[model samples]
Target: MEWHNWSGSVSAQPRTIARPRNESELRAAILATPRVRVRGAGHSFMPLCETDGTLIDMSDYDAPIEIAADRASAWVPAGWSLARLTETLWKEGVSLINQGDVNPQSLAGATATGTHGTGKDLGSLSTQVIAFELMLADGSLVVCDAEHHPDLFQAQRLSLGLFGVATRIRINVLPAYYLEERVEARPLGEMAERWQELAAATRHFEFFVFPYADTVIFKSLHPIAGEDEMPHSTDIDERPFRVACELGRKANFLIPPLQRLMMRLSSKPSRRVGPAWQIFPGERTIRFEEMEYELPRADGIPTLLEAIGYIRRKKLPVAFPFEFRLVAGDDIWMSPFNRGVGSSISFHQYARMPWRALFAEIEPVLRGANGRPHWAKRHTLGPDQVHALYPKTGDFLKVRAEVDPAGKFVNADLARLFGIERK
Candidate 1:
């Protein structure tokens, strides 16, 4: 909602949008509407938050966070954006153990959808969660964690916004540490050969491979020992070829063919270094829809290469680069990396192109390799398939039924997806 979802690909229409200032208001809204769903930053490419009944905007629920006296943890309002939360917590000398690239997402929204970043040593953001306060549809509040209401805690961590509205979350905090990032253009061959070692070497690791280009950008990050130390050796914009590539991307639609042309013409190695956030937040000005999957780390490289080969052979206009990342698994029920280390492959095509065909071409390859789709990203899998994938699906539904038996918090789509019918 803050940025109109920038993606602008949503198709859902809400009967009304409600902004609640507190738990009582949210409970009242839930009870009042026969059907409802919560909307976050609207970053989800799919219509998970879609509802004809009502939409709850938790944006107004932002409240100041409090750090624990031990400095080991802190609590934040569910609706707070990652950007504001990080900036606020930085002043208190603490930071999230890991953060996704873009920080514009709300806390509950990001966690609910299993949004993540890459790090073998570090896990996805939700894995750092210590506890949360959930406002149930029946106007009751429940606190959950690994010890208290363990089932609810696990399921709600990445509940796809189906369980209830989370009002606050408490997460383990790490001492704020500066990060030094290194980036280099490497051959795809190197990625295949050293993938395992590379994943193990850094605090965070990711790569980008442009279609029709022989080169791949390998990026790594590590914690810096001291403050005030510069993260990278040189300015990121020094590479004229990379700069040209970035500029040309802005006009990709008018010059879609130019991308392949540029890749062929300016084929050269490039490098850059900076802080973790700076390096991670690279410009993705090109417009495209993404489908990502998280798989066990051991199967990651093989699955990705096989998918890439399929794309190349099929000659899909997949002009946008592919993204590969690693993250430690969490207990979040619907998270792709829920139970183990995960390797993610995100592919995209220009927005104007027919997404249905492209996605159809790619889905089989991903599914063949045991990949689980990112809940917020584009994927056709509904509740039946979702239950088959997640181990705790049944338990989550049982609890959800008890908490919102009237289906007050469920949208029609969600009801069908979860196979829940109001009695």
Candidate 2:
């Protein structure tokens, strides 16, 4: 049998698959295999989950959420999907501090990859974690937190599953809140003209702009009194968009006109009020290979425009839109948004369209702007590039080595990126 990621861009044929039902079983499964790699929701676009030794699945490992006595945080099973975790937390009168637009990722997977939402003051999910319970390479369990194991905790915040296998995560939460979501179509020029005003207008703000199009789908979400109106239905047939992508795939030259037509038809005004969890994640069934970069906030607009200009000038048939937003920074050792307030730009292409070559052509534009790619997204950085972009790569590797000395979690791609020698 074969294991593949959401976009079918990465796959692995492991020697064995272990589905652990409990901690004892999980430990036994790990100790029984010479090498192990944990499995999450398989949402990563990169080869993070590719393994040849043994693949361990924890989706079946479920437990009740343990709220802190002060009600400031909760211990959640790392294997639970963000969709499940957020819904469950809402019922407990609490909510996650922030959430990404797509929510199928496991709690640990999101945190490890520095998954985030749009907010100038809100940091990524990794920053919300208070502690972690991990299973080491020797199958021994240990807990790490700011007070107990500072170095390990710092590294685990965004370790990309390198340091250890996270079994449970202590995450901060807030009193349940509601949000009013608004969407409108606007001219592309408006992005730069009112960048500061737009970012400050809402708690969550973002825009999606297809490379060949002149308009953008602007979206904003802010706290609301309650659900005063019906929420937007997520039940529209996506065939129209899919058909457009297919047309472009067959005849690349028709991309620009097709995109303009689609944008014109999609221009509409709509609003919805719903619980924060429900409003945070949008339905994302359309498959696309994505590459995301985090840059200094000042360089966002110019860099995005340059990249988009190149696509338009070259008549590139890129099929998906570029998502642009803001994310607060953190001190996490391996986080791309750790340096300072950052601007996040995500480049995507319809899964069926030609992508790698275009990504190769544009990755340099981002890198030249001092951008750092999301670990789980597409990027072709060698070890030196990785070390240069992340000054703490040595520190992260040090902790990774200390926890998993035998390199139990290192796979071929990871080995190449981290300069680790594989036996």
Candidate 3:
């Protein structure tokens, strides 16, 4: 079967591409393949579920979600993209308790990798999952929650779908509400002082600091008191299509130095206010490679500032601001943000630009802060380093061995990184 990824960055000729209409079909498909991997929207940058084996496309099973009246929780298909799910929940007088920057990811894809959004009060998307239905390697159905099969449930939340296929999820929700977003462009020093309060006060807050300049854009989302107004700003330069054009003009065919120069000049700040969905996820059509690490919240600003200093002194032409956001720690054994109050730090560079030099430059800061890289983003930490980052790494590996003893779910990449075959 032909192979293609959602990002189109990585693809291979898979043995087969299976579109299973239901659980039985899915199980049969998995059983047919010597090895299998699940594919959703393919939003991930890293090759989490990539394999030359059979690929399961969960996109065909989209259906209406059933939710409790309190807006507390609901069950949804693993195939549903965040955009459709959030919009549908709003129409039902409810909304997802948390969201990430991109809404194109499938529910299982996002939660499996611990994809998160910024909000001090809110946690990563996986934290809201009260229970999840898994189709094990043996083609057996299992319902995992805090009560039954708790260890499996905890490990499965952000395990990169290593144990089994996630068929459905029961998630926590919130009342459908509007957010009053505020964006400010200010000096970096000022942002450092207000960072803690900013994270604590706003429902969601994130800031981007451009290199070669002190200018930083800070965004905060708060609940609206009265009736919310319609979003008016359509002509913003930061819109996805325009940004894509800008990046194409700068980096597409040009040399790395030229791209750097363009980025240095293009660094600017802007603001917006609107609904939660509108404000939370922006149009990021411009494709750039990203590397993100989750550090303790207490060390967030310091780690960010240290990296900023390194870039400035080294004369690295970083076109974008250092992106920073927070997520409450979860109980997921494999989740990087499971420790508590995780602060995510992301580095962005044009795909054509050489990354080894830049990644080497930033690796020290992450190491010093005891950071853990996001599973779905770019990183080169080996299994030993990954084990050092998560206290429960051994336990998670044990669970994976028990659930998939034959290694039917394993790929070369996962096998090497996780040591699944040996354990």
Candidate achieving the largest TM-score: 2
Tens-place lDDT digits, model 2, residues 274-338: 88888888877889999999999999989999999988787778988899989998888888887
Model 1 clashing residue pairs (backbone)? none
State the C-alpha lDDT per candidate: 0.74, 0.88, 0.76
Candidate 2 accuracy as lDDT? 0.88
1-423 per-residue lDDT for model 1 (tens digits) = 222354677766667778989767887787776778888877788777877777888878745688899998898888887877777777778877788877778888888888888888677777788898988877788999989988888878777777788889998888876776666777788988898888788888998776556667777877775455654433233244444445544554423355445444544544444344444444444456888888888888898888878766777655467889988876666677766888888887656556668788889888888889887888878777888898778888887887777777676666777777854
What does the lDDT read for residue 67 in candidate 1? Answer: 89
Cα deviation in Å at residue 37, candidate 3?
0.9
| Global CA lDDT computed for model 1 | 0.74
Q: What does each candidate score in C-alpha RMSD?
A: 3.8, 1.3, 3.4
Distance (Å) between predicted and true CA of 275, model 3?
Answer: 4.0
- Per-candidate TM vs. native? 0.88, 0.98, 0.90
**On residues 205-278, what C-alpha lDDT tens digit does candidate 3 reach at each position?**
88776555565667777777436565644313554324543564456433234434434444454444555655
Per-residue lDDT of 318 in model 1: 57
Model 1 stretches with alpha carbons more than 4 Å out: 1-4, 226-285
Q: What TM-score number comes out for model 1?
A: 0.88
